[model samples]
Target chain A: MNAIIEVQDVSKSYGGVVANKRVSMTVQAGGITGLIGPNGSGKTTLFNSIVGYHPIDSGSIKFEGREISKMPVQSIARLGLIRTFQQTRIYAAMDCTQNMLISLPHRKMKFLDAFSKHGESDHAKAERLLEFVGLYEKRFLNAGSLSFGQQKLLEFAMALMNEPTGLLLDEPTAGINPTLINGLIDRLKRANREFGITLFIIEHNMRVIMNMADKIYCLAHGEMLAQGTPQEIQNDQRVVDAYLGTH
Target chain B: MNTKNIIFYVALLVLTAIAPFLFPDFRTQLATLWLMIVVAMTWDMTGGQMGYNSLGNILFYGTGMYVAAVISIGMVHDVGAYTDAGRLELMTFTERQYFVGAIVGIIGAGLFCSVTAIVVGYVTFGLRGPYFAIGTLGVAIAAGELVSNWGWIGGGQGISLPVYPGNFDVGKLFFYYLFAGTGVVLFMFLKWLYSTRFGAAINAIRDDEEKAEAMGIHTMRYKLTTWAMAAFFVGIVGGISGFQLIHFEPLETAYQTTNLGIFMVVCVLLGGKGTLWGPVIGAILFHFIKEVTWNYFLGWQWVALGALIVVTVVYFQDGVMGWLAHRKPQSPRL
Candidate 1:
């Protein structure tokens, strides 16, 4: 399959601390890719770099073969490369429907268009996405009032509102209950299948990532430790050691 | 559009139209109330709605006052000569010039402040939270100091424009209508603005800037635009105040950071920050309190005002609307 996102030799650091070093990976279009790393292993940093959240120290990031490392976060997002936070970041003061509506790309609209009401199709799509994420009932409530898992679901719906080609989820099910985790995983997979959206997920839960990702890349100490099917990476000594070493 | 809503708005409109005539003795005080409302509501645009609590919005008010005065004077006479303290002869504006100057000057003030907001926001928006607040405050303070030193525009002595070319009471009515007209338009504009997608975008920026940006919002553009719009209204009101006062100095009357500047923030806090009606309600309540304390508690007015602020901050941080919302959960949020 052709790659939707390509990151080559991407390095990022904070002051004297190096978070990611010569990190390289690619996410295939219409596929679920897993990134498994121990805490502080540069998974989030790499996600930030790919989505233009911060400037990378060195390296190249390509979305659909177009250079986007130098672009602003909003411009890169308009190109359909969007990232969610490790801690779900919904517009807390706004209701879930508002959160969804505001997530529509403002790239093509003129400044004056901002004052226009959300169109019928936009509202319909927002409702559909909310239903998809099982947040239809909570759509009218302020997002801040929702529980953490529900907020995550709302955030997921919001991300879907943009119709991103590639979605970078930072631990989508980290704080979610086990019962909800199963539902979230199912929805995520369905999004990939039905919408043909590529997903590059950073997950700490081994069983979940192993079950979801067709191919998994494991990182340790800011470097790629292994790249293989979940079955193969599960047996890799370095990947195993990285988790054990961190613990 | 229900009967109740329609009647309420009609009555409010009638009240606004007759307020100056009804309270002829307190026309000036009523005009100042509109001033407070305009500033507070505009302040809420950036401070409450967008979560960019700026302590320096008075910069626009001061700038608008100067721009309006200069434009008004420059139309009929040399502004520099008119403002020159040593000038021997009095410069006068005919009735046509007076009305024309005021209209053009007020509109010019609004436009000029909009541009200033974008320029100043470019530098200040880079600083977040308290740093942004402090940086803007510095800009206003520096402007005041600079204008005070610059003799071209009256220096620290300030500028005085020709009085309204008509009967005195008529002039009061003229300024009162100007202020009331602006306040009503601003209130209506904000009512519509808060219901738009732009409103959602700004609320998103307020909720979380990073997430808003990551979600494909041009957060900086929204921020700049919101501030510029707010400054435009504030500038217009400031122009009206400049004309009403007939004389204004750079630091005290025009800039007035310690007074009107801080009052706007307190007004927003007293009213509810993000809610549309909160600032307007808060301004009225604060103005009433200020007048009461100044009149009745003369010796302890400052102390009493401080106490009121302390109580508002500590006990009622949500302001009147928020308190009401808490009391009645069914109350609709603006």
Candidate 2:
């Protein structure tokens, strides 16, 4: 598979403290790639840098073989690289359908198209997405009224509205219940298999990372500790030492 | 629409429209009051809904008033000379000029405000909480000073619009209705926007800008858009206000910078920031209190308003909407 996103020697510092120290990674096209690390392990920092949410101190980022390290967040998004927050970011007052509709690019609608027609299309897309995530029944309900797990699912579905080529999910199942985690995993898998979209996930859940990731990279102290298939990573001495003490 | 809500809006609009007809003497005065409410609602669009806390709204209002005054005055003076016969001068040059200028001015103001917002966003968007508020306040002060010093458009003394030859009362009434109609249309448009996808993005931005950006929202673009919308309406309103008063003085226009802007902010805070009807309700109530209490109590009216603001902030942390929202019980979990 072709490398869709390439990060080369990227470093980021916040004042005196370094968040990402010369981090480099390649995300392949059309598969679920995982980055597993403990808290403050620079996984999120790296994700931010790649998506242009944070400026890099040095090095380059290439998406579709074009440099995007200095590109604005909106332009980068237009290029089909999208991301979701670790925290659920949704319009609390808006219904679930409205939340999904906002992510659809403005270019899709012509100026003469009546707003009601736009609303209809938005409603249809929102319903379809909600159904995919099993939140269809709550489409009309305020997003804020939904449970935390459901909000996470809504965030996922909203991100997919733009039809992104690569998704940067920061802990898709982080705070969700075990029952919903299964559903979250299923939907994510379907997004990859059915939609043929590439994914780069930063997760702390071992089961989730192992079960869903085609390849996994481990990070510790803003540096790569280990990278391989699930079995290889599980048996790696460095990975084991980083997760469980020096024993 | 629900019958009750529809009835409420219809009744409200009818009362407002017929108010002047019933009380012709106070027609112009009443419309001006409602125009102020519209200005307050415009402020709420950015400061309340988007959580931007912009104090530079006066900038747009002032610009609008000047633009409208300049166009109307320029038109009447230039065209009045040619119309010997009372045939309602066919699109006088000044009228045409004024229209072009007003459109250009509105667009220019929108662009200017958007750019200002973009710069402010880049600088302060990273700063969360109180720092963000301070940053916006600083921008307002700086922009206000810059505009005030620019001497071309009456600088500090201000410009006087050309007095039309028609009956002053009728002319004033016409201006009043024009502003009143504009306010109603603007209010409706904003209400519609509040229910759309753009509104969702704005709400998300308010809740958490960083989170919204992470959700691939292009938060900066949304901020700029809100700023432009606010500027466009405020500028047009400002222009009409100047034309009504027949003065385009910066200090008079900029008078809005201090008193009216703060008043609107207070209105939004007291009523509720993000709710659609909150600012309008707040503006009307605040205006009524000012008119009634000040008329009666003289000198101490401001004190009452201050006290009310303090009490509302303390008790109704979410403002009136929160209080009302809390009164409704939540549905029991199944």
Candidate 3:
């Protein structure tokens, strides 16, 4: 399989503290990769660096063989790599469909088009995405009025609106109800399998990481502790010690 | 478009257009009122809708007025003299020049404001909250001082357009219709803008800048766009007002103190900040209050206004429109 995203010896530091220390990883196309870490384990820093949210002190990030280590977040996004916030980011005043539509790639309408009597074909696509995320019923409802889990679902739908090739989800299931996590995971898996989109997930939930991740990279204290299959990661002493001991 | 809303706007426009014919002398007065509404609404675009809280809207307005005045005066002077015999003086150069000058001035104001906004955005958008607001105010003050010291256009005293060789009432009537039309167009444009994808991104950035960046929304671009749009309309309105009044005094145009700026901000805040209709409603209400209560209250009018502001801030944090929105739903539930 082609490597969709490759991060090589990426490092970032703030003042005296190192947020990411020479971390390296590769996300293969058409697979679900998980970055598992305890609190303050540099997962978010690594995510930021790879996604070009923060400038890395060293190392390079390549997306589809192009060096994008210095590209701006919007440019990186335009190149078919998209990220979602751990906390929901949505237009609260807008309806759910409107939220999804805002993220659509090519909005052909001009300033006056909104007032004129015209409709975009993207409306159908927006509705379909909403339906796919199980948010079709609430399409007309204000996005802010939805529950936390539903908001997560809406965010997922929004990320896919640009028809991204790769998605980086920051704690996709965090604060979500236990029952809904399975549905969220299943939908993500289907998106991967059916749409051929790669996903890199940063998750603290062991159940989610273990069940969904093909491979997991464990980080502790700004360094990677281990990289292995889910079963192997579960049995690894270093992983256990990092999670249970001082991290 | 919702049919009811469309019908409502059309009816309002028709009524406004016909009001002059009905009332005759009231045209110029209503036109000035319309111009104030336009300026206030444009200010709301940046301060209220996008939550930038700018106090520099007067900068654009002042510049616009000067630009229009200079162009009209220059053009009219160039063509106003022809004393030779046997020629039918088609239209006095002053009349033709003023007409052309108004168009040029409007365009110049928009361009100037947009460019200035870009520079200001670059400088101050990096600052957050009150710092940003203060930065914009400082920029406006500095700009005003620069214009005052420059002796090209009547220095600090001001420039006056030579009276057009036509009936003054006709000229006033023309200006009234022009500004009124512009006010309607700008309001509708702003309303449409706030409903767009770009506007959505702006609101998201306003709510949480970091999260918006994470979602791949370019916050800087949205900020610059909002600044430009706000500046464009402010400049145009300022230019037209200056042309109609035929004067461009720096201190008066730039609003030397915060009086007019504060009044416009108060209007937006009192009516409701982010709502499309908030600023217009606020402008009309504010003007009515000033006209009705100022004579009776005299020196205490400002004090009363202050008290009203305090009550609004305390009780109606989201402004009157927000309070109404909150009240409307509860009635059905009750």
DockQ of 3: 0.29
Question: In Å, what is the interface RMSD of model 1?
Answer: 1.1
Residue pairs in candidate 2 whose N, alpha carbon or C atoms collide under 3 angstroms: B64-B235, B64-B238, B64-B239, B65-B238, B65-B239, B75-B94, B158-B249
Instruction: Give the TM-score of each candidate.
Output: 0.97, 0.84, 0.90
lDDT per residue (tens digit) for residues A1-247 in model 1 = 9999999999998999899999989999999999998888989888888888899989999999999989989899878888888999988877889999999877667888999989998999999999999999988998999999898888888888888889999999988989989899999999999998899999998988998999999888788889999999999888888989942
Full-model lDDT, candidate 2: 0.74
TM-score on 0 to 1 scale for chain A of candidate 3: 0.93
Model 2 lDDT per residue over A1-247, tens place = 9999998988888898787787788888998999997778889899888888877999999999989999877678878888888987777776788777776754344432323334666678878988999899999898999998889898899888878889999999988999888878888999999988899999988998899998998988888888889999999998888877562
Task: Tell me the spans in candidate 2 whose CA falls farther than 4 Å from its real position.
Answer: A13-19, A105-117, B2-11, B72-152, B247-249, B317-322, B328-334
- B1-334 per-residue lDDT for model 1 (tens digits): 6999889988998999999888999999999999999999999999899999899999999999999989988988987888888999968889999989999999999999999999999999999899989999999999889889889899999998779888999999998889999999999999999888999899989889989889888889999999999999999998999999999999999988889998898898999999999999999999999999999999999898889888888988999899888899877886
For all candidates in order, the CA lDDT equals: 0.91, 0.74, 0.78
lDDT of 3 by residue, B115-201 (tens): 878988988998888888888888878878877776666667676655545788788777888788888888778767776666666
Of 2 and 3, the candidate ahead on TM-score is 3
**DockQ (CA atoms), all models:** 0.83, 0.29, 0.29
RMSD of each: 1.6, 5.6, 4.8
Better of 1 and 2 by TM-score: 1
The residue-level lDDT of candidate 1 at B120 comes to 97
